[model samples]
Target: MGSTTIGCDQRIAWLLTSARLLNPDPELARRDGFIKALADQGIKIDNSRISRWESGLHPVSGQVAATYEQALGLTEGSLVAVAAGLRRTFGNGPAPREGALRGADLTDGDMDRLLELIDEGKGTGAHWLRLVGQLGTYDRVYLRQQEWAALSARLVQELAVSVGVGFVRRYEAAAGLIRHPNAQRHLTRAIGGFVMNPDTQVVAPVLSLLTEIADEAAGDLVLRMLTSEDKNLRSAASSVAAVKVSRGHFGAHALPQLESHVVGSLRRGESLDGRLDSFDLAVQLPDESWERAMGGLRNRRAFDLVIGSRRGGELVPTQQTAAVVQRLSAAVQRDTPTHSPHENDAMLRRLLRESLLHAHKPRRHHAALLLAATPYAPAVAKHCQDLATHSNDLMAARALTVLMRVGHRMGRSRVLLQSLAETRPTIRARALVNLGLNPEPIKPAEADALLGHLDEHSRPVERHATMFALGMNGGTTLKKLAKSDTEWMARSATWWLDQGPALHDSDAALDQIGAQT
Candidate 1:
């Protein structure tokens, strides 16, 4: 068998005519307008040269073919493919028999069969490429037929598989073809399914696709995803927005809104769980990612919007990022009833040890608090005591509060006693409140000495802390402080007196004092 070939001149004529018809601007069909379009893409060819090619006096060259595709928004390689006889024409024309597959002809069973084949072919690059190529062809054919419903269903299924296998190119191709409103609806439905029962595998790719579309609806959806509680979804959404803004797909109108959302999330201390991975992916996006970020400043006069801009430097884990602390604390409290005594002791000790050493302050504090809140264990108690004796003021304060709440006797401890007399008012106040909240009995002299120290301080914050500490002691002092001269002090003292003595020894109590003052 021999291959049939189309003449280069005829192919160029067909492509040029199709480009002219598809162009919204009728003037683009003219030689002067076409020349300007080419110049817009930085291709400066003489006017006579373009006329020569269209008049069939000269054949199109590779450079001109590429520029034509770019200027006219034609698919990459379409003109060159036609010039090389690989394709017959452009503009939703009938595909060659080998690439032809109608959406109307495919059944649900047929779609399932293709998906099964794609599944079976996973991890084989060549096989996946072939399958995706076939799918792309089917997508184009269906798109031309306006069978959006059928094509959208097929695309959604293909996207699921493509994302699972990490076939990004295939996933992009499937997404790129989803330009129709019906197809967008189907993709939205698929996204909803993932939201209800999140599968991390599809989150990144699906978000990438949605942002690539970059329409208003997609932008709004991405915004909603940014605020999602699911860490994976929010992480994916952040990455997608970064990619879109970097590539300039994020429209100028929507850019401000996206920036505001990102800033708001950062302000709220929302943890982007997979942030490192997302940043790595953004950095890896073919040299254009950096170029795009820089180009925003160089050409577009826009700010360089990138992930690094959001995360100033270093991973400063806050309360939101301390998920491990929350998880281990819950497990420790719940597992005690089920596990053996030795096992529970070892488990809690291990968790507390790991948490105490964590780089983040919040996690360390949480671990110490969890240890204090759980049933008494000697190892846990020792860990909390050691942390309380540490030099870090915040850590020491949290550890001391935990120990006091759990009924640990701190009266004779040099660290706790010195902390009460510290020059820093906040530290002194915390130590005083912790001492007052001590479940063990305090001598009248010790309680009277603490109350007398409060009379020495004129600061409202000091006065507030004194009132809380006096309230915790449960006696005539609380009644006297409730009617003190300072209005805020009196109010806090009254509230504390009304509530009576309950174990109110945590950062929350300190925060309350600050708030009252």
Candidate 2:
């Protein structure tokens, strides 16, 4: 629990061992050789210390993580990211999910199957449509060069003039893929091509994509496009990537230009640009710049790699983090500001509100997560009443999500219950998924109705997600489903039952968890 406390994490341990064994330099791969390499980097660790890390008794982080990556010839931030990202999931704590990852975790087998699935479906248009739709939900993936070349082409081809649902699904899925290293190269090119393309249909969608995966390369590409004769292109790029002239690493060099917007929004009590957030600034700029931007926006864990370094920060949040966001809440409700006597509390509330107002749906949805992870009291409910009914449907839904999550803390479910009547599958499913968070007692009729509706849902993925919600709200239906449903669902149900009951607001558990990823 101490900041410097070392803990063994199974995933990081495996990755460390694999990196060393696979190294081509025999000396570098040997235990003694690896130690010498670290020593050369001025990391004074002996056999016992190195063994401690390799054996999973300590997690390499901060400076040590960087040294490990460099000594092993892996990319910088690689090891650090694995450590920060897993902190929330595989912490050295007593909790149900504080263990190693499971079926949801991606492996070589999963990637192999997915690549084959893409190859098999490439010939059929209907199959490509379905394939991309499904791929959108995946946070991490590996694509062969040929497959990425093919898929990236298809994405641009489809999205260049897409309207409504097709645009939303493909664009979002591609943005989600930014988390995987291999996918980012091809994905960036696809987005960059679209940015240069003059198609009006994709203007909004392109900006949305840029916002989600903004980085130094992306910042430079968009900035260069600003001088084009096309008026629409100029307008869209400027709104999202506004920055003063800069030469190298446009994002970092021009951090002040981009951060001005965030600071102005916080100071003026206005919504932040949908395309940006403080986390982006933190990753792009040096740690010393943190105080200057927004007069010092500081998170206790800002230096953790996933939340800090450009490499780790730029990737889509790891898949586990993405999956958890999907499970947060589905309800809608009214207003109440969290009356805090503390100035910092007031500052945090302002930050959360403006962030929730971001035009980017995913960023807005993250507000619920920010709240869930902060150790605030239960009084903060439906605070962003204005946003809950915003014209953007996703925005409104996300606002409702914030309230529903807050209501969970309050042991109240009015907004959550009200949302269940929603006719849209997305809406209704979200409500079902969120019901797992509400601690209020559910009537037998209500619980049965939830189970019945969950069983009847058409999509297998949706059904699987609802199973998680139901498991969290364990009752007769959970017990019944533990013995029924598909083998996976039944097994998942049984697992959830043993994971213990859902958490209460008083637990103060989510604080310091999932803020970065």
Best by TM-score: 2
Give the alpha carbon lDDT tens digit for every residue of 96-169 in model 1: 23111111234455445555644443222222233333444343333433344444444444444331112333
What lDDT, from 0 to 1, does candidate 1 have?
0.45
In model 2, where do residues sit more than 4 Å from their true spots?
Answer: 1-98, 104-113, 116-144, 154-181, 204-216, 228-232, 239-352, 355-365, 368-517
Q: List the residue pairs that clash in candidate 2.
A: 136-173, 178-316, 179-316
For candidate 1, the per-residue lDDT at 516 reads 7
Against the reference, the lDDT scores of all candidates come to 0.45, 0.46
Give residue 154's lDDT in candidate 2 (0 to 100). 57
Q: After superposition, how far is residue 116 of candidate 1 from its true place, in Å?
A: 64
Cα TM-score per model:
0.30, 0.32
Query: Best-fitting candidate, measured by lDDT?
Result: 2
Residue 182, model 1: lDDT of: 35
